[model samples]
Target chain A: MRRPPRALVLLAALAASFFAVPLAALAWRAPWASLPEVLTTEVVGSALRISLVSSLAASALSAFLGLPLAWVLARVPFPGRSVLRALVTLPLVLPPVVGGVALLLALGRLGLVGRALESFFGVTLFGTLPGVIVAETFVAMPFLVLTVEGALKGLDPRYEDAAATLGASRGLVFWKITLPLAAPSVAAGAVLAWARALGEFGATITFAGNLPGETQTMPIAVYTALLRDVDAAIVLSLVLVAVSLLVLVTLRERWAPQA
Target chain B: MAPARRSLGRDAAALLGLAVALSACGGEGGGGGGQSEASRVTVFAASSLTQAFEAMAEELEEDSPGTSIRFNFGSSSDLATQLEQGARADVYASADEANMIRVMDADLVEGEPSVFVKNKLEIIVSAGNPEGIRSLEDLENSELVLSLCNEECPAGKYAAEALDKAGVNVEPDSLETEVKAVVTRLQVGEADAGIVYASDVASAEGEVEGVPIPAADNVIATYPIAQLTDAESAAGEFVDFALSKRGRAILEEHGFLVP
Candidate 1:
């Protein structure tokens, strides 16, 4: 194997230490003796449960909605397509807290559409599970969309054309050929989206409001704990770190693009 | 060869860890203005003190030319933790004594924190009081969406205590981490009612209306300010200035009661 350049290696080593030291410190001071007791509390349990449900729901919704949006952005050349794509990925750059405020403006009780929903059906999305899901989806969907779009763009279109010539319906070609070919990217995107949703804080709290066993996901729970008990916050954070590491390891092993 | 590969793997892990760490720091605002020239003072304060502190900063600068003041504002609990984490700030002002005591216990401050102001809670509703919420009991109606600060927040703790005293068990749709967030919820009309400081209601102007909490049931929120041991003499001066009559006038103008 060729030796890597020395300057690059030194710079990379400095960056590595910068990142590794803090995490090492966290692990070192994690209150190891009380970890089990702290993690077993009702608050932690509820927050963990809610985090799983909301993030999973966000991932599923992103796969369902973002996939089609990505396909359109990649395969179809239409007027203002670039604009549409920018809008789709806007949330990726927008502050999640600002996204939450936007969500409230669009979906809250006094929101433009929300007022109608309230008067007509008495359905309010604020401070509910659906609201959390919506907030997470809004913030996380952009990850899936951008990922899948990149994948779709990179796919060999000759295969898709070959299927089309075989008298397969457009929908059939999509379901049978396009989706399977894009499966790895879709899985990768979903996992990335799920991770983002799981760690989501600003938008979720801003739009859905934090209510324990209602809308208080893990991040909110950890934040609340941080305010009162640093030990509890540390334990909660350790659990999150563990979960994220597991997911990243799994993704790297199973779905990472081979060199 | 195996050792080299292990080190490479560790480097990759550290890089990934650092990426996560950097992302978190990016989310939160940092302390200090990064000024090299001129005497500088940095104050970490509760979010409720935003307006008053901004005004005080101007006043401080006017009194002593070339003395620049910077501020970091958030929930007091978060500020205390930042101090504990060794964030570089000259003075610490908290909305509650508990958080201030946490920093004091850590020996972050030079002397006892002086009570600068007292605040009380009020129920905020959107303009017109659309829900016809007239009193604390009216907030308990399951049909109305309510927001309150998180239990870890001074305002949240006080709100919970007052509610308990009133024998009202309201299921708030959201427990915002900051008292300001509760005010935002009410301002945007996302929540039918929210509990926040009277100062918040005053600052929000006509966007929200305040329903006075019965004085007997309402909890008084005391704000404490202290100079850090590591801060410059200017930090001590600023703290004294904040506790001075002129500073009290600025805070009172924003609806905080002088202690």
Candidate 2:
């Protein structure tokens, strides 16, 4: 086979290098002197704690909701299903800010469900932890749904039929048969959803608002730092990067089977 | 997942690139402004002033033909950092003076940034006070979720400063990026209360209720504007209009204080 031209190779290299440049730059500018203290600040700590907890909750919730939706979208082909699929994936196209606004419209105190939630249960989502989780889940669920749906369609159905014939309930067959086979994709989806939730900003801010010890996550902390305190912001960003890398690497390991 | 699988080679490369890009992109706006003057003057300012500034830009084009203005509207801290890293803003109008001061300390500004306008902090709640969050002290209740701008954002800083003065610290649920977002959450009831600019609350009108915080009197953040050291001839005119009679009127109409 003919080799790619030198100029083409250079162009591709240039395009690819935009990724590495920013990371190298961050490490280069890392304020090593203040990192330890910055990382431990009460505000940073609280935000990080919220970030970790909310991201995990959202990721788990998304998987719980997304997998079933994925299965239906993939296996139960029906009229307008493509449109339905698009609607489910809408958040991917929607600006996180817009998704946040939509969430507020649906869940805010004056919102339809928001009004019901307050009158019935005295619960208001705005500026609350539940609001944070709701916003994160709204944005991240699509990642899981699309990922799991793809795996479902690519799955071998005969095994599920074999289990059904052996007296397995459809639910049990789904739980025991389809899920195991799709474990890696599901895991990958969960990881993506988790990561998205962990780093989420616009939707969370619009839907949940930042409050320390409540909904302020690391990304929000970092953003605040960049304006209020650059050194602190840099340290928080580094922390976020380190944690994200660790999780992404672990997920990437699980993703190797597909590779 | 199937699409990812099909595009594995390209997508894997892109994904890793994107992660790196995210890490790198976070800090780049501070390092690259060596371009000569007279090409065009790029001014990054807070979003709330988009209408007035764009109107000013249009007027400037008519008044001073050769000179041109490009405005990037967002939060002040974002713009400041962008200035630090060499984003090449010839002028900046921050909703809070502190952000303006931050950029000045970096020696990027041309002169003392004049206090062009003033923004007051107000308690923004959903219309009808559905939760009856009567005042600022109510935010401290664990049941309330609040959103504020990250510390870097002008509005967030002002609120924090005001809260500090009042000796009230409520754990907010999210720290957003801008004032508009904080108000949006309030309107949606994602946050029962957000400390936002009086202008934001004023703009929202009927969608949300604005309760003036008495303690907020201590948190009047002066908005500052100045031509950067890097300004073209156009900078002088822009600054004049911002601080001039017509400019003051436009900002006043938007509910900003005439400095």
Candidate 3:
């Protein structure tokens, strides 16, 4: 029944508008009428497909790789555990472009490990579909790792211990008891990682290189369109906005815990 | 709980409206500052002009002590899009005529753009030309990885033209956003060869070797400079200076052809 403080309201209002106006402008200037034409084009179609596939794949890989790391960090206290945790979260703060460059230097044809891989197996990672996935996973895995790690740390160990006491092996206890209880957190982390990967730009462009129907995900396509067709770029941006909003809304209702 | 939830929703809606209003108030503050600052000139140039233009900016500053020149360099299409979006730049020197046409189509330019310099496509290979990429046709060897700028960039268009003229149908490993990225791909050995501006090869400083395209197959990419319609008087002066004999000499030193 009481009004909120006027100063707090004023500050909140300013911050909200600052965050919302750019999206509003994008909405206002978007070529809504020709959106279907723009979105149905070969370029948009391929980019959308690539974005979806790469982000989803990145999410799966993140869950696969990050869960074990999270488990180790949360349950096993090693000498350099904190340092290892810090290194794992580096992608969260590193500029995506620098991350891409690092990936290239470590995995490119002439890269340290890449040189051996190329000469031995005649396999190349650069400029391939797998390269895009690798770049996205590199930037996105940290989200899953931190989230699942937090969940693992918070989870009661008594349930796993009880299962172990009943003769369940460590692996069995983890798969049956620990994983089920951590399912919600894992799902949340995967969604967050997928969303992050979907919007990846700098690393993908730098490491994977932009190839249409291959490495040119939605962000790269939008960037290329900005260089060619502004209206088309706006249309692509609107598509991205729509995708992100959908993700947010779905997550809030089905996954995100209320404050 | 129901009452609290209802009130929270109402508060969010009210805050959203307030934010939109505040944003409207903020938007009006930027357009008024351009006219009062007459001694400053902001030039938006193509990415390939970065070194030459930086040198030119220093020279211009020395020539006119009180006037300050700022340069914004990126892909020509990107710069043109910024101009269309009403970026407050005094002059735009695009890497190609098509991008200049985009700006002119928006009625953003005050006068006709003059061709100040020209650039040609070169097949840039690794230091020793390990892949033996000697000509445009060699780029189509399928075994040799290749990179090029995205089709939206002037360098990409020029590269495509050169390839088409030579009847080469090489599938690029990656299409970069600008000439510099293509050059970088070659220098890192991520690509066996890349098509970039001759100036980019010159700037690579032995990191890569330039395989010259035959004159008959090469595309002469022209740089166009013009003042914006709403730019300050100093913009025109800067444009003139960039087109002067000294400017041509500087561009030549960077491996650009005199127009």
Candidate 4:
């Protein structure tokens, strides 16, 4: 192996520092002496519980719904497939606040379908735990769909075809052969979805509304804390950063070992 | 391997150039001669003052050619935090005395802030008052979805006071970060009722209706304005204009009670 150019290495180091400096600053300003007390506060505890429950629920919902969508997108060859893919992945790139507005329009009490749901079933998702899950799933599911689709498309087709040739049913081949082969990717996708959902702020606040012990997740807690208590906000931020770091390290080691 | 490495380095260099070019494009309107900088008076004001401030800015710019007035509108607490964190601005206006005091305590204000307007809280509901929400007591109905500004915001503080005075105990479904968000929630029909400044209801232009809060139960919010310590020479001029007769008229038109 040859050494990289000195100029390229210098630029790369500068780029890395750009991301590192802010995290370092956050750590520097953290209230280390009071961390335990701050962490034990009811606000922090409630926000943590809400964040954990909603993010995990969002990930489960994403996997349940995304797997089938991914399989279809990867295997089916149909007209407007590209358009369908674009529509499905729109949430991945669209601003989360805009996604929240769209959600309110579709599912809000006075919304097109929201009105029907409210009148027929007396169900209103706005400002509820279910609303937070819905908003998170809307933004997180696209990650799972895209990731699983890529993995599904990358799989060798010979095994499935061979299984089918041996007089196995489609369901049997899918259950015994396809799923096991894609299990690792599915797990990776679910983790990515969970991480994205954990950090969700805009959509949840916009759609689900912020109420402590209910819709107020960690990110929202940090924001609210920043307005009145900078120290508390810093502590909450550190918690989020620690969680995100753990997720990244786990992903690198267990899911993308080759990288 | 050497050839591939060289091509990769070249591509990286190209990417770096594109990034620099894009940043240059993004900076277009913000960059210019020192003359523009001197003429640019950036005023950070509370979100409830958005409509009135914009109108004042238009008139001020029209009266003084070559002068540009830029405004940053958000929750008063958030703006105060930003000013304390050294965000550059010519003038600061807060929705309540508490936030103004916070900035003064931080020594960010050039002089004492003067109260320029007084606003009272009102119950905001969808157009036609579908839920027939007539008073603060109506907000307590469990069937109605209520939204209020988070307690960290001035509007929220005022709303809480008013609700307390009215002896109403309502658990809001969501606590928004800004007064405008509360209005948006009401406008979008996601919330059945919310408490916001009377000016906000007037600014909504019939999208929502305001149910007057009896003066006995309403809490008044006083808006204060001051030039910042680091303000440019023109900063004082903008502050003066906001407190002028014409400025007061614009605010009054928007339902504010000019002091």
Candidate 5:
């Protein structure tokens, strides 16, 4: 048995304290007695529904797009591909508000595509449910792309080539061969995306505009309630934490990469 | 070696017990004494009162010995919630009477609320007024992408009332969470027009142009202030100074009506 390095020990101690203090504070102040009544409120319920529905939608959308994008980035060799990768991951670094603003500018009714959609097709982005979906997907999809890309790199290309030799088409090989091999990784990506979307605040508030039954997800509800009702904010927080934990636990069962 | 291991385990348990005790007491030996000793006044005020309220807080600090001023500026509703959650504050100044009434109903304030000032709604546009949104009627044009505060927020409610008075059937492109957001969207050309306070438009000199929405029948949100029962002496004095002539002068400078 050897002693841990001093710096690593210090880092571990600091990290442990950092996470423990907040959990302790939350437990200390939580009005556990009133939780049942608080959770049943229309505001909390509506916000929770929106949060769950949109986060799930956002995670699904991310998987649909990000996995393919990750595969391309990992396997394909193209001009300025690194730059493309950077651009795809830009939302990961950009402030969620900035991302929301960018989404508004690009997809807003008067946005580039927005203008095109409105001029010919009469589609609107502002104040619509689609706006919430767009904002969440924009922010969370980066996690999926990065995670899946890592999984793609770790996979054996020889397996896919061997499948091609057996006469499977590219799409068939990807769906039947590559996907199953990366199923855990893809699921991990989706879980990350879901968590990001669940906690998303700035982007949804900026882009979706907090309408009670419309765009007010759990985080938004927590913020709105922070002024009007302290108990509501606490309740919303517990809902958010509980939901995130449950999802993580379920994903741990299905998505955890086993040795 | 066995004794040493037992001693380490005992020490760990003792440290954990002390941690719990420290949290329960809410005060510690000499560690948090410095924070709780000097009576501090915390004022939660509306963002519109930033310039005026800050000046008042400064004056209070200069007037009272060993007194410090803490200012939290945001939407009135947010401040109200902070108080409800046992936040130590001396005074609360809301942007509107409605939010103040809500806080009063929650029994967060000490005495009867006073109408400190009044704020009138003003139409804001991009610096050039490109849309030519002269009066409320012009807002009804479907082509105009107008932004306003949501109905729940003071400014948004006022904007809605103003529009209703003029018999305008304008559909806003988006309802922002705050007045500044509406102003920002208009300034950025994302919205052709918005309705906010004249003082807010004044602050956006290079970015936006302000137009007085006819005050004859328009909504005028009355601002209210009250000291909280939990406030220490220093904070209470600070509240008194804000209601003094100097505070009125600051409000007047910011285009607020003397009550």
Candidate 6:
């Protein structure tokens, strides 16, 4: 391979350092001696539990709902397909706070659907665990859908056609062939969605509200802790950073080894 | 191709001329002989002061042309933490003494902060009192969803104090990070009720109504304003203006008690 230009290399190094500096500063300011005590505190513990539960639930929800959407987008030749794809990808670009406001408008007690839900079933999702999962899913599902859709589009159709010629049903061809072919992308997308959900702050805080052990996920906990306890906030932030780093490293090694 | 490139070059030159003209206009305003040089003062204040401070900024700017005020509004504790972390601002106005003391302890203030206004806690509900919430005890209704500020927020602390004083053991469905968020929860009807400063209800522009907490059970929040140690000359003037009679009248009109 041809060597990169020196100016390009220099620019890449500068960009790398720009990202490294803040992480270094956080590490430098971390209270390493009190990490164990801080991590084990009730606030941190509950936040961790909530973050884990909500993020996992969001990832599962994304996979269950997104797979069909991704398949439909990839295989269907329907009018307005591009518009539908754009709408699905909208949350990826929209500010999470704005997403939260939209969620409240659609799901709050007085909202269009929310009012009906409240009146008929006495169910309100605001400030509940389900609300956090909903907010997370709203922001995170696009990643899974987009990733899986790309994978589905890139797959060779001959394998499924060959299976169909062998008298296998469409469902059997999909389950026994197409799904297995796209398994790696599915795994990668699920992990990406989980990481995005774990780091979600704005939408959850705005839509679900920040209640400890219920809606106060790790990001919200870190923010609340930052106000009163710098050390605790640093510890919580470091945990999130470490988890994100792990996700990236694992994805590179398992799914994109060439990179 | 050559003509396209030539037209692009002309477009670039036109853009450069426009930029130069804009900067020239800006320079003339600052360099005019008889007028004071344009100055910008950044004030970091609590979210509860959003409307009243914006009004004060408009009045102050009108009174002294070429003087502009920028605000960074959030929870008091968040503002204090930013000051401690060396975020530069000319003035700091906290909703409670505790956060102001935190900044003072960090040596961020030029001198002692003076109490400029006081606020009392009130139960905020959606317009027309949809739930017919009338008092603090009404907040205890199991069917009602309550949102309050987290313990780190001054309004949250005040709400907790008031609740304690009233011997009301109602559990909040959500603990928001800022007082404004609690008010927002009520405004959006995500929450049946919330406890926030009286000024918040007044500033909410009738989207929400206040159910007055009896004086005996209300917690008074003392708001203090101070110029930062690194502030410009205009910062002191702004602080003085906030303590002036006109400022007091504005605060009173917004349902705050002037000191």
Q: How far is B77's C-alpha from truth in model 3 (Å)?
A: 18
What are the per-residue Cα lDDT tens digits for candidate 5 across B165-239? 888888889998888678667654688888888777766667779877887647888888898876777766766
Off by over 4 Å in 5: A1-13, B1-259
TM-score of each: 0.53, 0.52, 0.53, 0.53, 0.52, 0.52
Per-residue error for A200 in candidate 3, Å, reads 0.6
Question: In lDDT terms, how accurate is model 2?
Answer: 0.74
How far off is residue B3 in model 2, in Å?
25
Query: What tens-digit string does per-residue lDDT give for candidate 2 at A25-88?
Result: 6878788988787776666766766777678778878978998899899888799999999898
Checking candidate 5 for backbone clashes, the offending pairs are: none
Q: Please write out the lDDT profile of model 4 over residues B1-259, one tens digit for every residue.
A: 2333344335434534643453344333222223544487878887677678878988988988768776655567656755554445789999889889999998989978889999989899999999998788988899999999898887888899998999999999999877777877776578989999889888876778999999999998899999999788888878888889988899999999888
Mind giving the per-residue lDDT tens digits that candidate 2 earns over B127-173?
A: 88777876677778878778888886767877888888777878989
Model 6 chain A poorest 10 in a row by lDDT = A250-259
Q: Could you tell me which residue pairs clash in candidate 4?
A: none
How many pairs of residues in model 5 come into backbone collision? 0
* Candidate no. 3 TM-score: 0.53
**Lowest summed lDDT window (length 10), candidate 3 chain A:** A223-232
Error of 3 at A178 (Å): 1.4
Query: lDDT for model 6, on a 0 to 1 scale?
Result: 0.80
Give the per-residue lDDT digits (tens) of candidate 3, residues B1-259: 2343344335434534643453344333312124444487778788688778878888998988767776555567656654564445788998878889999998988979899999887888889888877788777788878888888777888788888888988899899867777776675568888988888887776677888999999999888899998897678778888899999899989889987
Candidate 2 Cα errors over 4 Å, as ranges: A1-16, A254-258, B1-259
Model 1 over residues B57-85: C-alpha lDDT tens digits?
98889989868786655567756654564
Cα displacement (angstroms), candidate 2, residue B52, comes to 26
Give the range where candidate 2 chain A is weakest over 10 consecutive residues by summed lDDT: A223-232
Model 1, residue pairs in steric clash: none
